[model samples]
Target: MTDGPIITATGVVKTFGGLRAVDVDKLEIRRNKITALIGPNGAGKTTFFNLLTGFDQVDAGEITLDGQNITGTPPHRLAAKGMVRTFQLTKALAKLSTLENMKLGALHQRGEKFWQALIPGLWTRQERDIEARAEAILQRFNLTHMRDEFAGTMSGGQRKLLEMARALMTDPRVVMLDEPMAGVNPALAQSLLELIKMLPAEGRTVIFVEHNMDVVQEISDWVVVMAEGRIIAQGTPAEIKSNKAVVDAYLGAHHGEDLSKVELA
Candidate 1:
């Protein structure tokens, strides 16, 4: 039996003035699967991400998540709907303690009431549970040591890790990551890769934008290739490794960029 996709986009289009940033014909993120959106610079990968996450409106087309049409839902609404995304640039709450920042994500978990804000018992009941869960998450991400530290003091990769951990605090169904490995040092990048690998094990849907072919090959279950605001190729890592269009897009005739010997692994 085949399960329906967790996220689906069809005929999606987005234009910025004279430029068409995203023109994907169709893209599907399978339930509990890891999908990578890969492409060269200016491939429209980020634009597609924005459209799916509702950071920007779509020019035309449809987006369905878990059987509901969420085409133009705002980012905050989507977060409440169990779809949370992390940016390519790390978005740690600078002044908040690592643990406190994660607590904010948990506010989306059960109740977010103005009355509950005024009443002590309503929220106090869950505070212990929330704190336990948050600590567990930080431990899982190997960030327990920095739980009480200010988020601003951590390294770039640690902040990225914290971001991913915070998103999980909502118990999200789909995690859309925008270039999770960008600008990360090699050592921490590997740590992030391991975390990405563990995401599917936790039964969460993982979709990410990335330029690192090795990381893409390591973590992605399905690959979608985009170029010049259009999807040009998509397949498994091995298949994409040998595809002509992908090759042309990355290393065309005039560029003389030979990557045949350069293994993503």
Candidate 2:
């Protein structure tokens, strides 16, 4: 990892009609560390995520990935440049087999080109390599048994796992996950949490949007709290736990209430 932030956002803004959805003066994500973005519903957490990932155009300001300007770069381009993200909703292609879905995530495949695809000999070796890589990742994710099965046949949690494993196919330096634990069973959520915690050890930075404070406290090296389209507080988990601003944002009149137990917004 580098000595500085892997991602930086400056003067970023996004508005929907008259309402500003995201407005941030500056934010920097440290390298090789897990950062959690937390807020109540409609706190602009997801909007900021979209702006950073190129799913939505920023209305203003600069976004940089490893010092290169990437304010308006599209998602596929970002993936090629070592930045990739998974959606809030699992996006596994329903009809595709698990292994096929993984192969699709591999970048720069010769078979992806029309003329090259028509000649099996031209890309056969590369295809085998891709499959082997996919199998290894599936094994790591404990999804090897589902390799030939249709994605639509898997449970919600398994589909989430597949999406995460596919993102790894790009060999991304930064992985952004949106609500990974949402809608997952407790056992699967714990499994996913463990996997997320392992990313930094594998040389990838993680930025995840989640409401589960327990998960955040367990895995986050830094916590950034937002409210009403702006970052209200940022600190380590212990510090954020005691920050008055975060408490007020989550529980207006109930200041002394336990922040973790109260559902944010």
Candidate 3:
């Protein structure tokens, strides 16, 4: 399932008011690999994720998925093209049942058509199949017990699991997770970590934005470091851990300086 880059970004740029959030000359996401995007709070990691996933339009440059240009494409359209993303703040529908939320993630549903809705025969079988698929996915995430419960009632970790489960419903080839472990409990974070490690085996390219250095070091096949909307350094985990640029991005110039002699602010 691996060949060349599953995703490519060239001269990409995004701006918010006067701030340039993402400005990259080029980047490539290798097929079937787990790539972690990491940096300090204002490094534009999430903004770049949005640009690639089409949640926000790019002010300049191009993005491609499997060799097709996808820059400026809407999120839903990008989903249909085998690219799907989960948000840092879980996007589970509060009022919808867990299973219903998973069902909504399925792309190109016949039931979504007005005329198809009038004829039960047109979408009934497909509806059953979708439910069965949803159930299987819920079971995989150990969320079968909450299948019929309102999404809002689940804990933060459970919501994160549900959001990841829903993303799977689309059978996406590329999965982009924005802070998937944020606000999750330790126990559930372990669970999420294990599940993420399995994506490449399922032939999916996984790109995630994470602040936890431990998690990044443990699972990432490659790491990209960003600073002030530009990529500062990138390499394997061990290499990135020792990279001077990466250290500077997170700790700044005074990283190794002793503070004992410094005066208090």
Candidate 4:
């Protein structure tokens, strides 16, 4: 619905030893919409996510967020700039309390500096504010009861929820989720799906790597298909479902069979 992309990348490339993991020529993520990035196992979807979010360096390319060049910016710097991401495997701090982990996602904490932290007057009010915000988010994710529990003690699906909730602690403009549904149980999966769908309505753009076509079709406004480290198709979910290139990307060896039978990752 927005006039232009919220995030754009040109000539992006990432290499590992002799292999080029990602080689996206150009990509645009629409503002305030959910865009699903779907690809096969070795198609480099996750690698591309890393390059875009600054979790990994791009060998060559320019990445821009809201028209500002952010190429090679570090993850923390990117977070401060309103571009935050969650990992395929949830990255909740194992030993930290759930509340503590969420609080860590808040940027520019006065208590982080040694001298400023020593002065309770300088940071106490802000710390209270952060705690209040974290508590509210935990309640939204249904984790308020576990606020004081160690993050490592939670189930796989709960950790995923925690990771997503923590990313919002930064109040990001664009949230990139990598395989948010992987390992999540069905009941929790549905809740995650609803939460993701609600993000754009709350004024945040979402770009996610998902393997489930059903989930992609149900929630995504747009879909980008990738194969062998390159994007081959982009369109609405309906268009992507019918695109020959997309079908072939997923079922190259079985192209002669019914395209509907092809299971897209």
Alpha-carbon RMSD of each model:
4.4, 4.2, 5.0, 3.9
User: What are the Cα lDDT values of the candidates?
Assistant: 0.85, 0.91, 0.91, 0.91
By summed lDDT, the worst window of 10 consecutive residues in model 2 runs over 256-265
Stretches > 4 Å off in candidate 1: 107-111, 252-265
Candidate 4: Cα lDDT at 44: 92
Model 2 RMSD vs true structure: 4.2
Query: For candidate 4, lDDT tens digit of each residue in 1-265?
Result: 3568999999998889998788888999999999999987888999999988988899998999988899999999999999999999789899999999999989999999999988999999999999999999999999999999999999999999999999999999999999999999999999999999999989899999999999999999999988767787789999999877687767776534543355554
State the displacement of the C-alpha of residue 155, model 3, in Å, after optimal TM-score superposition.
0.2
Where does the lowest 10-residue lDDT sum fall in candidate 3? 256-265
List, residue by residue over 1-265, the lDDT tens digit for candidate 1. 1389988899999999998888877888888889999988887888899999999999999999988999999999998888989998899999999999888888444346776777777777687789899999999889999999999999988989999999999888899899888788998888878888888777789999999899888888899888778887778988998877787777654243433323332
In order of appearance, the predictions have TM-scores of 0.91, 0.94, 0.94, 0.93
lDDT measured at residue 27 in model 4 versus the true structure, 0 to 100: 94
Q: Which candidate, 1 or 4, has the higher TM-score?
A: 4
List the candidate 4 regions with Cα displacement exceeding 4 Å: 254-265
| Cα lDDT of model 3 by residue, 1-265, tens digit | 2487999999999989998889998999999999999999988999999999888899999999998899999998999999999999888899999999999999889989999889999998999999999999999899999999999999999999999999999999999999999999999999899999999999999999999999999999999888788887789999998877677657776444432222222
Best-performing candidate as measured by lDDT: 2
The alpha-carbon lDDT assigned to residue 116 of candidate 4 equals 99
TM-score of model 3 vs. true structure? 0.94
